[model samples]
Target: MANSLPVAVLFGVYLGIVTGIVPALVAWTLGFLFRYVVGVTIPGFGVLVLGISLAGVNGGLLALADPTIVATTDAPTIVTALLVVMMLTLYAHSRGDALGAALPRGAVAWRAIGERTLSVDLAEVFGSEVRIAVEGPVSDIEGFPPLSADTRTAIRETDWRLSADLPIDELQRRLADRIATEFDCAEVSVQIDDRGRASVAAAPELAGVSRRLDAGQRAVSVDALVPTGLVRGDRVTVRTPAETVDGTIVSARSGDPDEPSTAEPVPHSGAATTTGGEGRVTVGVSRADASRLLAVDRAAVIVRSRGRSREIELLSVLRRAGHRVRSVTLGADPPATVADLPGTVLAAETPDGWTITPAADHPLAPDQALFVVGSPETLARLGEVAR
Candidate 1:
């Protein structure tokens, strides 16, 4: 009987291995395929446990199907063997369930963290208004190349936290040029703010606007006897140290806060101060003229070239055309006019949870969602404003 027991135990062990081979192969194949589909690296231990668990389940099934292979006359021993097989299968299956849920979620969380880190890094190195998203073949790679020592020094000198004398506009132009030249991308886009901050991206479906509103415009406050004749529609020639530009009178009014609207300019008064001592004229000139005009300690003289009304369009028609339309929340505060935006066109504004065609001059309030059409750049720029 002792010899018979040994022979039976040997046969059961053989049977378990024979049954487990097919299941182990199948389990490994499935795991390999699943890893590729999930796009995440699974640890070696997970694969091992999964293979063993699948093998255990197969062994248990085989024993149940043909009990004669594993069972002897000892009913208690046979039952104990079956239970052990069942326990192994259950434990392995549970572990597999955990891996299936955890692995994919971990991959997604890691990707989000990576994107956020890149956003902050790009913004800091480039400009605060500068935002970037990269994709395609090289997207998976992280970090940027080192800048020249001179470039680094220039950036550090312009840090807003420090007292520095670098010109903001020049820095913006230089950085934008550098990025455009250095980066090799299937596609690239850039956006600039009023303060010359840029947002750049690669492989972007939509292009960002590089146009600057103040690029060619300068503001000047004038106080003189000649200010009285200058009207908003009057064309004027402004000469500054940098360059001369033909500009239009944008606003002409008394500088005094309490003065009545009828304050008139004194022709040839040649006086520095008006009767109210508050009469001031504000003019819009080209940026070149502006730099020179602002630099000088002397007063700016304006001569009427002609009288005309010209419309300035800040929005881009080409960028807005053929763009994928999307809905975005307008946030608590939005800019005054839809026309004020450079890259996007506001199609509709939903307020109070109802949709309506938005008027260009309509007032924007909180809790409003906007439907806009433009490229990815447009969406990005609008997102900054909305936030």
Candidate 2:
């Protein structure tokens, strides 16, 4: 007698639950363990192989219980069983992957292991902000010169806190500026990630008067009774017995004229130092005037009164206009010239020194560095090209 439609449907459902559902559950469990515990992924083919192996085991057990059932099974029934197993296995594996990703790491381990076994947190959370801890010495990028041992030690010893709320690019710029100022670096690069981790690369300030000398200018030391409260970048006239020489003071030290000056050169500012005595002054002067100034043993110094600096005013205006400055090192394959850059080229530093506002056609080379000014987007595009 033929089976009724309802009876056949019930039988098929029972068979599916026994063969398909059971194997699928096993596959899902294995998939979850692979992802969450082993930190590995199982491919679709591997899952299919597993399902087939489980189906064969089920078939063997069923045949052992009733040999007549194996004899009665048809090609179509076997094909249907395999298809159901494959489909269910794939669905279960996918669900397992979703669950694995949703759950936190070691969630299952909490039953057997305690919270103390996990890694310590490096970030502190407060209301709306996260502060990342920064320890150890700052790292230098490959191919760039390393900072001094003292600078490395200083950076390591200081406490640094980085906020995750600020824009990363702006934060990096601010941090780089702070490091440069505090450590007297000529160039500083900072990178911060979404997790509030930071990496820094810094180059020490260039030594001596060479770094400060401009084109067509020479630095010369002159013996004179420098005025009280004199400082670097001061406009002054050296009145010698023969003639007066005009120059800007590169550095000044007020002490005994016969002794060497150990005082560091102060940055460009209107405020004068408290130093007073007969001391030597390093002055930046034109090539023609350099020789005349060198011939004199001693001269009287006259400080020239000047108005507000144009460079400072220009920089302030640029900042107010939402422009930013960035220094980039050229890669092995860089753009042909300053014209190819996306932003305005402020200056290019080569082995021969800096070229201010280089012409469009000026050639570029590997390892050369340049400063560019532009909007954040423009700078971002330029950074990719430079790298």
Candidate 3:
């Protein structure tokens, strides 16, 4: 029996080395290498746990060390152990879940976290308009969930806090670039407000525009001097740097507020054109526009090269294209015209662009429009449903 035991022990060691030790060692090594490379990534803790657990299992199966014990257990026979280990390993590899081998890695699956945005005050960035640089944390990135209808939120519970010392403007640009890469989107844009708030936006135009308007709080005015057609008292919702507020059309006047309105309209007491001599053709604006024109009569108005009127502000773009912005309001319909904006949506004018918010319950009409101030090279992409 003692001699027989010796034979069994030898057989176990042979089995362990040929099947268990070699394959298991290879598996554990592969798993360790994978985690070493990927564990440092953001939100990889779950994967890390899974990888290490798999490595440990491989190590146990391999029995690479302690050959003496393995040889003693050889009574079960090295041949059987080899056959079992080989079958298991081959089976694992075939299933494509062979984590220890590192051939089959977990795929990145994402849950859509609906997009939400915020507008920020510029007080922190600057009391007045000052271009500031923005920086973003590498850890927090744009590989967020898919575009969904749910509200997306950021929480600091499970991961480390992400912050950067980069200036607001620089950070915005950086984030824009980063998010562009993360989402494999080439059209990302980063914007930073005076208040330290930054936004990295990308996606279809409809979604992008919606996200932009809906984000945060800001102070703004409506009908800010697009063309002669827009007038003060036109009634528009004003969105401030802090929140969306209802506002009246103060003026879309161009130029200095101190200028008098009658200067151009009033010819010198007895000018040749009107009094003593031939009359000249003078185009005077309407009563409402004349009122606003009076405030800024000092500055020269630049005529657009193509259109009869041009928007000096960004909100005018949205307004021009017939796209209006409103939060979800109780009504099922949007404003029939810009005149109804004040009653339906919140809006404002900024030197850089226009800020707008819509009523949550408001249903978008085919005629509803978003007021964009400047000309954009890329057109907004709309969904089939919205279209």
Candidate closer to the true structure by lDDT (higher is better), 2 or 3 = 2
- TM for every model, in the order presented, reads 0.26, 0.40, 0.23
Per-residue CA lDDT of candidate 3, range 1-387, in tens? Answer: 223755765664555445454444444444455543343222233433443444445545656676454445533564545455555444333333334344322221111123221223432323222333333422322554343221112111112111232334434655565445433343556566544444444542234312323223222222232334433233343222333333233324343446554444432121112111111111233344333433432322222233434444545676566443322222343334433332333543334454465444433455333532221111111111111
Candidate 1: count of backbone clashes, pairs at least 3 residues apart or interchain: 7
Which ranges of candidate 1 are over 4 A from the true structure? 1-3, 10-87, 101-152, 156-211, 214-387
Best-fitting candidate, scored by TM-score: 2
Worst lDDT 10-window in candidate 2: 111-120
lDDT of 1 at 46: 63
lDDT tens string, model 2, 1-387?
A: 334555545544445456777679988898887887557778989899988788778877877988866655655556656777788888998888778767754334232222121112544545434554444457775556778786776655545543333455656776787777777677887766655566777887757578777899999888778788886778999888999889998988778757776889655332447378778888899998999988988888899998888988998898778676778888787777788777899999977799999999999888789999987546656544555
Instruction: Tell me the tens digit of each residue's lDDT in model 1 across 1-387.
Output: 222666655554554456445544554455444553453445555655555566567767776887864544354444344444444444444455455555532233221232212223334444323422221222211233433344333322332220011223333444444444433223433444433344544332122121212365667755533444454545666554555556666555545667455746433221223232335555677665666666654454466654332311223343234344556666665666666553445454543555455566766666566677665434445544453
Instruction: For model 1, state the Cα shift of residue 243 in Å.
Output: 25
TM-score of 2: 0.40
Best by lDDT: 2
